[model samples]
Target: MGRARCWRHRSPRRWKQFHEGCVPCQAVGVASHDGYKRGDDTVMVDGGVGDSDESGLRSIDLATLSGVLRVCDVELLLLDGNGPRAAFASRVHEEALFCSISCGFHCRGRFMLPPDWAMLGYLHATDETLSWCHGVPLTPGMALTVMPEGISEFTLSPGTHMTLMLVPVARVQRKLTELSLRSTPPAGQALSLFNLASETTPLAQHYQQLHVQLGQGASLQPEETEKLLHEHVQALLGAGAADRPGCSRARRTHYLIAQRAENFMRLNLRRNIYMNEICDAAGVSERGLRYAFEDLFGTSPNRYLSMLRLCAACRSLSMADSSRRSVKAIALSCGLWDLSRFADNYRKVFGELPRDTLMRAPAQIGQPA
Candidate 1:
């Protein structure tokens, strides 16, 4: 894969400020690589720079049958399937996890959001679907109702393409207050997932169009994004969570455990810790630990831990003095044992190597001469 060009960021403060303001940032850039085959039918694009934080275009490459992409900062994951199964996820700060996906999968969890974000989306099938929302079959178009929370399992059939936009609750509430209207923004479970594609409503049609644009890796303008959020909130306010207030107590317990575990992970990022330690810290059993992680992260504890540590290492590299410490030393401090693998993963995610980032750090902020 070819190396990506990076802007010289002067300091960690600049990085923080840039990311903090980039709520609707673009995902763009392309790097080709040797294909790695998995099992019998899956192949991964070996090494590639997915996008730069300051890049103007959203991803140049589309995830489809012809090409496979595995980018890190956007947290792209393509699971093994008959063909290359792929999904793209990028968070707009702490407000949301923006997702564009084309895959057939099954998930068992309820979103454990921080009470400030609301999940919204538009989805349709390229072929027939075996998809279900809550307990009912989710068809192409219909009037919607609030779905009960803590669904046991949600399934999607092959050839399902969708766009999920997570809007902060504060944004929705503010929008409603501005219009002199008010409605409860049920945390995505109690609103209309099925009728998002209904042809009868202009709003639904607009959602489909926006979803298609997002699938093509187009960035919505700030105004347009706000409009979409407002539309979703207005629709949701019509149907509050109370309509489907039959969430399982067991699932709620899982969410509580997951939140506690996440808090523990954040506080102890500097220290290398294990799953058992986290379980003890959260006061949850092994099974509850598994359930908590799967519900919140959609992955295992080990994978999530690695991600946290890697991010911590990146922070150090972005702010530390190269004269005082080598990349290997900083990595070891963050519990990363392999230098070669760390550089590769770091470049794939951030579009630059550790040394490259350190070189860009301003002299005034890093170390005492």
Candidate 2:
């Protein structure tokens, strides 16, 4: 039996400290003695954390294997010795890595990895073979990875004990492309250039040099980091995750006008501004502003102004310097005279009592690009 402890670290300091020492693993243990069949439609494990962070790590004896699984997305699993070992399936077009950071028994003498990805195994052990259904050339290393366009599969010897870190394709690409050129080759390609015997390759050396130049001890420069963020956003967009369906041209035009109007509203949110004044501020006719705003944001200009005021009020409530401001004061300053309406709208949109959510939510919130 393997002992398992599950903990959730929420505080930035605590999470960093915990991650520094943790080793991740993923396993599909054998259900029958022969060691060649799926265990069950639903496998069970002893140690898994609940959603809440306050539960902390509860030390327990774990005789099974279970955690999170994604049939089509990436998952990070932490496996120890006493878990099931079965041929588990990975999601389609998903790349995975099982890095052997520690433990000797889990090592494999040699194995060919698939094209889109690779997995890490120890270099000394014998008797296990890993494979993928797809066509990908495998490489042996302590830091094995699968490319988004490749495969990930491996086998291990009996009584093998190892900890694995599953690296997703997106994660690796982001990490690599962050510091390299936009058109850098995939890791599998770059790694293949290395002479395994010597652990030296032009690509490896170049990558290491770039990593060091970006900051050996500190994080990357702001511009470099922003470039990486833009890449990630582009990747997400490529994945078709950013598109908003059912947005008609009229709707889009209306939205653009509303955005401009909202900008004007924010500039004058603190002052007494009339509807005509807002129309003048937006440089559009009162009827046009109303029609444009209605088409775009699905709200009246008057109602939008009210919502903006409430948004400002909520911001004030959540502000660190809000200790001196009352909710009523904020509402009145934002041109709203009704506290009940403000409270109601606040609760509906944010899903919490205004007071309770004020300090708990993030102070600097904005729309994602």
Backbone clashes, each candidate: 4, 28
lDDT, candidate 1, 171-207, per-residue tens: 7567756654544434433455434424656567666
Candidate 2 — worst ten consecutive residues by lDDT sum?
Answer: 59-68
| C-alpha TM-score for every candidate | 0.48, 0.33
| Candidate 1 Cα outliers beyond 4 Å, as residue runs | 1-25, 29-201, 213-230, 240-247, 294-299, 314-325, 337-369
lDDT of 2 by residue, 1-369 (tens): 011122221233422222332312122211222112112111112222112123122211111121212112221111122222222211111122122111212211112222233232122222223210111212232222223332222224333322222333345455555555343333323221111222253223322333233111112233432333343333322322122123356544554565467668867776777888777767778888989754433457876666556555654565523345566776777877767877887665444556654444234343110
User: Which residues of candidate 2, in runs, are more than 4 Å off?
Assistant: 1-252, 320-323, 338-369
Best by TM-score: 1
